[model samples]
Target: MNTDNTLLNAVIGAVATIGLSFLGVSPVIGGAIAAYLEGGESGNGIRIGALSGLIASLPVAVILAAALVFLPLTGDIGVAIGGFVLVFVVVAIGVGFTVALSALGGLIGAYLKENA
Candidate 1:
């Protein structure tokens, strides 16, 4: 792929990933939508999702790694399958984390009856 195309794809992927994650949705699904919008090649969609997930999860990974090193696991094995799994795992974790935090905030607000 051309450099420009790759950069554009990555940017598109990153934006979609962040937007979807904020909505408590899957980045991969958002990436797939981005890919379809960019035109077919589901594999490219996967790539975009992976790139997006990597970028989105970087801060979380760093914080978790520093605060809880034992919780952060990293390894390289089975190139194809492993890479795909890693991408999905990152996207899922990011989305789930955001969703869980949002739920917690809601519960706390409800408990405190902040709105009332």
Candidate 2:
């Protein structure tokens, strides 16, 4: 497989993810497409997929970071702390979901590539 193209493929997949997300499609499809394009082993596919997910989530991470930073400036300390924790948890879960699903999709894509 051409390992050199992995990053490019992942970027394409991230673009796909961003585009399809507007239509309510899952990021898994994007991940699968990336791995399929890479045509590598499962491990490599996972790496590509995870990278894609991470790339796609960059804007989200930035927004979440902003929220975290600014939330503390609002009103009471107790409310701010609570808001911070909630946002943190939401960010963690969202990132985790994207990465995990993308990895699974990569595995599936690799399996498909091997069999087909």
Candidate No. with top lDDT = 2
Candidate 2 per-residue lDDT over residues 1-116, each given as its tens digit: 43468888888878888888875445788788888888878998898888888887787877987897878788789989999899889888888888777777777777788788
Give the worst 10-residue stretch by lDDT in candidate 2. 22-31
As for candidate 1, its clashing pairs are none
Off by over 4 Å in 1: 1-4, 37-40, 68-116
For candidate 1, write residues 41-109 as lDDT tens digits. 444444544554555555566554353333234343355456556655775686566434433332332
Poorest 10 consecutive residues by lDDT, candidate 1? 106-115
Backbone collisions counted per model: 0, 0
Q: After superposition, how far is residue 16 of candidate 2 from its true place, in Å?
A: 0.8
**Would you list the C-alpha lDDT of every candidate in the order shown?**
0.47, 0.80
For each candidate in turn, the TM-score is: 0.43, 0.87
Native-to-model Cα distance after best TM-score fit, residue 30 in candidate 2, in Å:
0.8
Q: In model 2, which residue pairs have backbone atoms overlapping below 3 Å?
A: none
